[model samples]
Structure formats: structure tokens, C-alpha cells
Target: MKIILSTLNAKYVHHALALRYLSKSVPDARVMAFTINHTVESVCAELYKKITTDTLLGFSVYIWNVEMTLRVLARLKKVAPQLKILLGGPEVSYDPFETLTANTFVDYVIYGEGENTFKALCNANDCVSLHSIEGLAFRQDGQVIVNPPRPLIQDLDTIPSPYTSAELAAFEGKMLYYETSRGCPFTCSYCLSSTTHGVRFFSLDRVLADLRAMLDHRVGQVKFVDRTFNCSNVRTKAIVTFLIQNAAQTNFHFEIAAHLMDDALLALLKSAPTGLFQLEIGVQSTHAKTIQAIHRQTDFEKIATHVKALRQADNMHLHLDVIAGLPYEDYEAFQKTFNDVYALKPHALQLGFLKLLKGAAIRDFEGYTYCDCAPYEVLATPWLTHAQLLALKRMEDMVE
Candidate 1:
């Protein structure tokens, strides 16, 4: 048997990690992975030609894009009729039943976490009892069957590190990526990271081992993907101290909760070398009503002060973000957010529009209405109008 896991990740290094882990659990499974962005269709066709009858067997395709899933499935089916397809991730987990029923190409839908369920499906000898598998959805007797969800992985250290020495060696002096945690503690309504609803950190010793492995492989830069790297001040300080101790060999970056910073964190950050670290702070909006409406609690004044202090230190690069089309944020309100975040004068300002995904709080609210279009993004709200959204998008383009 053979299996293929594909993703639309911007980088090949991270995509290979998911593929490598899946391959390790499935015996004799020839696993091939591809990374495509805005080019899945053409890339799938190219890969189809490389597989012949002898090399091809039962295979599966993973869809992360709901908009492109049907089109890509149709293309893949024509190339390989025996291939089985699975849909998972945030895009499919939101509404699995409708997606599975509508698309004939998808054989199964894995909800929530996929690491264990994927291993089970690959090793199953009979497909009849597949419905008994937890965290999976499939069709049987013209009905959709959904199984119970698997518990979240508690011991993160047991999982193998995503980067390999050979892979890290490829980018000897360029880029490195690592994730120290799985989920976030905040409840920002617009973000999927908030859905997980708690903080889970990897073992400090395991994290140090991974960092040492990357450094030994000569990786110059490392980026932490934790949603809020500084949620636990103690852990944050320890990691920063580790980095500072190894500053001569590695440059580390983090995405942090700006309002959560304190004098202690500020002092440690100030002592780090310039260009050795970077911070990305997400200040979605400054308006109190807008912030409350989106279930995001932030102190704009304190955040501004902290950003100013970081800038004054002249040690690390800073990036800030703001979102348009959030509920209660009108054109004028968004302009204020833009001005406030921009005035901090970080390296860049990321102006984003609202995306309504499954399980988001704003999605359940009837007060705001969305456009019935392909992208399915929020079109208007009681406080924001359609015309205002279009105008604001234009302004965002101009400013960003």
C-alpha cells in the first residue's frame, strides 16, 4: 500500500514534517508529499503522470482548502480511479457532514486531531468497520456516521521533532521554524487557535534538545509558532534565557501577547543582542467596543507603552497586525486601529480582513451577515455596511 499527504504550506520544510510523521507510523507505505500554494491543480496533474500501475496502489488525498477541494478531487479522480481521499484540518472540521455528503470524491473526514486517526486508517485491514474509528466521519447506508473525538495529545515531548538534520542542513544560513506549544489560552473569536482554549507547553528539556539539534545542524534562524509565546512568564523567561545564552549561534523569533508583558520580561528582552530576536504582536483593534464584541481582551494603552519600551531598547524587530471587517469596527474605527498600530513604527503592518471559519463565535452570531460568494468572507455587519467594507478594503490595501 502507498499513501500521499499534501499541504498548501508556503514552505516545503514544514510540509515534509507532517508527511514524515505519517510515514513513520505506517509500515511499507510509500509516502510522498508536496507543497503547493495557489497552484494545487497544476501540481496535482504533474504528480499524477509520475505514478504508473506498478508504482500506484490505494492512495489518499488530503484537502485543506474547501473552495478548491472539489475541483482538485475531480482532477485527481480522472488520473487515478482507485485513489481514496480524506478531508481534515480547520477547513473541513467546521462542517464535515455537509462536505462529505456533497463531495463524492472524499472517502472519509477526520475531525479534530488527525495524528492517531490517520495511523489507524492506514493500518486497517477492512474498510467496513472504519465507521467505528473515533474522530472520523464517513457515509454508510446513505447516512453520515460521526465517531467520537480523540483526546488531545498531552505529552508533546514524545512526538518526534519536525525538522531533520538533513532538512535543517539545507538552510544552513537562512531560515528555521519550530513550535513549542500546540494551542492558545486566549479567546479571540476570529481565530481558530482560540477554539482549543488552553495552554500546553512542551518539556523544557525536550525543547532545549530540539534547539540544540537545530544549532548543531547550523541553523541560523528559528521562528517559534506558539500563538502566545509569553503566556506563561516563567516559561517565556527560561526560553529567552536559553536563546540569549546561545545568541552567538542562533537568532530566535516569537509571536507574543503584547498586553501581557511586564517589567521583568521587558528587562530580559532589553538585555538580548540586537537582531537576535523578533516579536509579532496582534493588535486586532483598539476600539473597546470592537475588541469586546470580538471576545478579545486587550489593553491598548498598555500595549502601546510596551511597544514603545521595546522600540526604545533598539534590540529586536517588531511586527504588528490589525483586522478590518470585525463586528462593531466601522470604517472610522478601523482607521483608528490602523493609525494606532502604525504609529508604533514596527517593521511592518499586516492589515487583514475577517474570515468566518467553523466553530468561531462570530459565526454563530446572527447580528452580522456574510456574502454568499466563493470566498465566503464577512460582507457586512450591523455596525459595518457592505459599501464601508469595500471602501475599507481599498484603504487597507493603500496603507498596507
Candidate 2:
């Protein structure tokens, strides 16, 4: 099969990390990544001209690209009915009921961890029954059949290297992301990281090797995709120590729960050079009950103290996040939460509204109304009415 993986990225400099991973997962796969700013007609025209009967096009569906992807997909199915269209990635991975049935164009969906499953599905022969493929969901004879789930890859080193591939050199200067870990230690209901608990690490040797390759290639800042980059203090320290010891011109970004920062990480951060490390702290909601309702544990005192300490040290640039419309956080309460986080004087402060992601705790959650779209943003809840949410959005606009 002539397999190709693609997605419409939010911008030109932003490459789709999942698309690269999918392409790296299957050696035979080619990639066609584009930006969403372009019209669907232009993109579809270019893509439709290249489709061959033997081709299998797989899209790394995400919130930003789903609408655009569907538009192109509908046109592709009309123009080349014989071509196969495969869907994967977070947007379609969990509950594809709507995507599979509502859109007859999608031929197959490889749910969960897609690397191994996609390789296996592509290798399967036409004569093989759909039921035989694990982690696959398909429509057959007007009924959708979903295969048994595939567990997350315990050994992540098996996911091939996109850094070492010559084809990826074209993406230089476009921000790149590397995953050193998977899953999260905390169960924050509002986030998808809650789905997979515990932490899994890629071999330190493998990670260090990839970093060396990235640095040698002079690739720009590499952001670690690990949910909680500092979840394991020992592992985090080891990696930090290595980066400090083997100084490179490359900058690294991490999303760390600031409360988890230990004295060791603090000491390291105190002395690290400016712009070497950038940390993003998620202070979702400051209301005690709101935090508890989301099943997140945090020490605001420590977070503030450490964040201030780091800010004072002038070592790393800090970005902090706040979510509006969390449970128990009314408009007034949300303003308080915003004020609390905003007071930190972070280099960058993010104001994001709650999104009831398909598989997140808020999806079928009671007393909540969310947008009926790919992103499924929370419109309102028992705690906050739609008008209040809109007010909060306007407040967010003021600061952001």
C-alpha cells in the first residue's frame, strides 16, 4: 500500500508532531502536511491531483484541523471513491461513533496508541477480515465494528526516530516536539492526561541521542511533550543535569506542575542559563473546591514561592495557565482565580476556557452544555451560565 499521513497545522512554522510520528512509525509512509490558513479548494485541488488508486491517506485528526480535514475528505471521496481514507489521532481515537457514521468517507480508525496498530493494519492483506485487526474501527455492511483495544506501548523506544530521517530536514526551524515520557501521575478530570495513569519513560540513552541529533541539525527550540515533565524528580534531574553538563545552543520547553518542583530542581533552575529552559505551569483554577472537583492536587503556596523564586533568579522564562468556567468557579470566583494566577507576573499568562474533550471527564458529565464541534468547548454548566461564560471570555480577551 502507498501509505501517506497528513494534517493541516495551525501555522506554517508549526509542524504536526503526530503526523511526523505516524510517518516515522511506518517506514513506507509519505507525508503531506499543510497549514489551515489556506482555502480548502486549493489544498484539495493539489491533493486530489496526486491521489492514486493504490494510495491510503491517513489524517492525524485534531481540534484545529478536523473541520478543514472533513471538508477536504468529503471532496476527496467524491473525486476518488476508490481511494482509502484512514483517520487516527486524539480527535478520532476515542469515540469515533460520530466520525465513522456521520462521515461515510472515513474508511478506518486506528484508536489508542496508533504507531504499532497503524503499521499492523497497513500490512494486513485485503483478504484479511476487519475483525482480525486489533485497535481498528470500521464500517462494514452498514454497521460499525470496533476491534479490541491495544494497550499503550510500554516500551516507547520502539517508536522510530523522526530526527534522524533525511526527509525531516525540510522542517528545520519549524518548532519540533520530542516525547521522553508518556501518561501522567495526576488525574485532572478536565485534561486528557487522566485517561492514562502512571509514568513511562524512554531510555535515557535514546532521548539523549535524539537531542544530540537535534542539536547537531541546528533545529530550533524542542518542546518536551511529556504531560508533567517533572513528575519523576530523579528522572527529571538526570535529564536536566545532562543538558546542563552537555551545553547546547538548543532551548527546551517543559510543562511541569510547579508544586512538584523539589529543592534539587530549584537549585538547578537557580543557576541554569537564561533561555535554556522554559517551564509552563498549569494553575488551572485556584478555587479550592474547583481544584478538588477536578481531582487535582496542588500547593498554591509552593507554586507561587517557587515560581517567584525562578522568576527572580532570571534563569528560565515561565508561562502559567488558567482555565475559566471550571466547576464551582463562578464568574466572580473565576476572576479571583485569574487574579491569583495573574499576580504571579509570569512572562506569559494563558487564559483558556474549559473544553469538554470527547474522552475527558466533562464529556457526558451532568449539568454541563458544550459546543457540538470537534473541540467541544464547554458553553455552560450548573455552576456558570452561558452569559457568565461569555463574560468570562470577554474578560479573557481583555488580558490576553
TM-score of each candidate?
0.89, 0.96
Alpha-carbon lDDT of model 2: 0.84
RMSD (Å) of each candidate, 1 decimal:
3.0, 1.6
Please, what are the lDDT tens digits per residue for candidate 2 over residues 205-251?
Answer: 99888877777666668889899999888888988888877666778
lDDT of 1: 0.74
Error of 1 at 227 (Å): 1.3
In model 1, state the lDDT of residue 16: 36
Tell me the lDDT of model 1 at 183.
92
Residue 246 lDDT in candidate 1: 79
Error of 1 at 59 (Å): 11
lDDT of 2 at 308: 91
Clash pairs of candidate 1?
none
TM-score of 1: 0.89
